[model samples]
Target chain A: MNVEFINPFLTSLLNVMSTMASMELEPGKPALKTDPIAKGDVSGLIGMVGPQTKGSLSITFERELILTTMQKMLGEEHEEIDDEVTDLVGEITNMVTGGAKNILSDKGYEFEMATPMVVTGKDHTISHKAKGKKIIMPFSSEFGTAFIEICFEH
Target chain B: MNVEFINPFLTSLLNVMSTMASMELEPGKPALKTDPIAKGDVSGLIGMVGPQTKGSLSITFERELILTTMQKMLGEEHEEIDDEVTDLVGEITNMVTGGAKNILSDKGYEFEMATPMVVTGKDHTISHKAKGKKIIMPFSSEFGTAFIEICFEH
Candidate 1:
């Protein structure tokens, strides 16, 4: 994937976490996705297509970390994956992706984004039809670890 | 949901099942989706975006039926949810949605489709960010029952 396409999403994720939950996230090494099972118990996925690129972006969070983030963002306690928790994750995904879209748009990478979809389970796999290597970026915070994946075909 | 947009999918589904697996499917009534838990153990989802429409189409199947269909489609005995089985479902989804797209395109609805995504689990939920009613079309075959869900924003 192009660095020009990757940076907007990375920047947006860091900004979203800092602004929404007041947490600082440290991004680790980026790698290609070879595992079939998703790294987290919950994931928010959005598909994007542009005049020059097409692919998907996913934010996956471990159960405990997501719950902790939710507790802080909602200013309440959440012990379970209720509707509110799921919605919060979805909203976060939308905001982060939205921020990325804005940045990419200014760079002349005109793209249309699909609605974010939330998939919940312990052992579930996501496979997109696009033929390309997917890039997975690992992030860690005080709450727990999460992954941001970007795959685009240009 | 407009009949103009729904019939093509139904027709394409029946055609795919009959042609690919030699199974005849009878579609039931279409209803609005309210339950968050997906109806089947395995599901094939494709997102569709057009000049005037934006939404998704999904075909979810019971495990047993998917297994049986794989057995017949591949002319072999398979008893597990292996990668091949998942790939078969993804292909079926792509074919069915491709058929529908062709019909819709002929009728002047130009749309771009994303690669199909498959989710497998005993009990799972799929939530889309698009704010609109989702139409669920239930179907029954000799093997088992399945669902075709369509949700779009005009």
Candidate 2:
């Protein structure tokens, strides 16, 4: 995958978190994902396809981190992973992906993004048959750690 | 969703099963799905997005049905759901979606499809926040029952 295709997602994620939740995040080293399971209790996935690329974006969040982030994001308290929490996860995924799409479209990569799909379970894995290089970007915020996984075939 | 947009999928699914697995199938009346859980142990999801439509297609098969379908499709006997089974599910999803995309494209609905995403577990649910009408088309075959869910926003 081209690093140029990944920069937008990183920028969008950091921008979304800081703007929406008022949480500053520091990104760790991006690495290849060897494991199958998404390293979180909940994940939001958005699929992307263009003339030259096909990929999917997954943002997995630890349970406590999402709960805390959502509470702060919504200006309310969420005691558990209710419908609101799930919706928040989906919205966050959409916003980040849509933000990336805007930048990518301007760069002449015309693509369409599917609606965000939220999957919740322990040890659940999302396997995409894109045969792309899978990169995992881990970010840390005050609430906790989360990961942005991008698998792109160019 | 417009029936024009959905007919291609139904036709492709029936055609894929018959041509790929040599299995004849009967589709039940499509019904709107209000529940969150995809009603199967394994599911193949393909997301679709275009100028006029944004949604997903999920084909959930009973474990036995998939195992048997794989056995018939590949001329092999499989007792359990291994990586091959998972791979077959993704391929089937891809083929069906690709077939449909071809027809839809000919009809002027040019869209890009994401690579198939396979979700496997005992009791797992895939929640999409598209707010579209989710219609599940159930089919009964000699092996068992499966469903093709199309959630499209036009």
Candidate 3:
């Protein structure tokens, strides 16, 4: 798997959310976090294909983190999570992928993305094809914890 | 203008419909024809980026075409076009782009896409911008007239 293929997407996602929500995100190391019930958990998954093989990008966040982020986006406090909130999260992932795709296009890598699917709940495991490497970048914000996962086969 | 990019997308769309609807689409040159008002005119647009400059792909159709397509998809005659019909057309565009992206990615072109936005009207003009090269593929089916436009800069 090309780490280069994954980095731009993660960076763009962070930049978009940070700008949209006006929330500060603390950057940390890229490593997979396996805890199912982590604080604010919202996950977005999108598949990609190109030179190498097919794979997916999954971004997960604790519930609280997403609520605060959504609050900032909608300018309203949300106590209960519903379709609107989930849709917003899915749209965010779609935008991030779009931004990343634009940048990668300049690098001579043309990648198309699938419509994003959003999943919310604890103890839900996302499985990717058992090839290549898994890279996870975890972030801590005033709102909550979030991570981006890239699974691909080189 | 790369006809290579355009041909695959159009073919994939026909292929998907053929497999799903069991209807054989006669291969013909891209041209213009008078379209009837079946259900209503529905259009969706989403932007793309990569080796080329900024551009968008749009899919439009009449209400009748949508109803017929949806009927094939759902295996039933729908009395009227509703939310499900609208979503099905939007999803068709998404799937077509997803397939095209796979080919582009393999060639090392990188870009992102915006969420699909649905629009309704009659005789709407769809535009594309690519290095000052603009091409519009107008289509007329049993339902109505629709087209896809690609514009980008090299």
- A1-154, model 2: which lDDT tens digit per residue? 7888889999999999889988788999998776555567778887887788777888988888899888779887887777788889999999999999999899988678888777776655666666887888889877778889888777
**TM-score, second chain, candidate 3:** 0.77
lDDT of 1 at B99: 95
Write one digit per residue (lDDT tens) for candidate 3, span A1-116: 56677789778877888789887777788765332222234566565655545456667777788888888988877775565677677778778878988988888886666555
Error of 3 at B111 (Å): 19
Q: Which candidate ranks first by DockQ, i.e. highest?
A: 2
Worst 10 residues of 1 chain A by lDDT: A122-131
lDDT of 1 by residue, B1-154 (tens): 5888888998999999889888888989888787565557777776666778777777888888889899878887778777778778879888998999999999998777766667776666676656677777878977888888777777
Report per-candidate DockQ: 0.56, 0.63, 0.03
lDDT (0-100) at residue B10 of candidate 3?
72
Q: What's candidate 2's DockQ score?
A: 0.63
Q: List, residue by residue over A45-83, the lDDT tens digit for candidate 1.
A: 777767787777778888888898887787878887777
- The first chain of model 3 has a TM-score of 0.87
Alpha-carbon shift of residue A25 in model 2 (angstroms)? 4.0
Say which prediction, candidate 1 or candidate 3, comes out ahead on TM-score: 1
Best by lDDT: 2
Q: Report chain B TM per candidate.
A: 0.94, 0.93, 0.77
lDDT for each residue of candidate 2 in B32-149, tens digit (9 for 90 to 100): 7776656576778777778777878888888889989998899988887666888899899999999999999998997778877777765656676777887778889878877888
- The TM-scores, chain A only, for the candidates as listed are 0.93, 0.93, 0.87
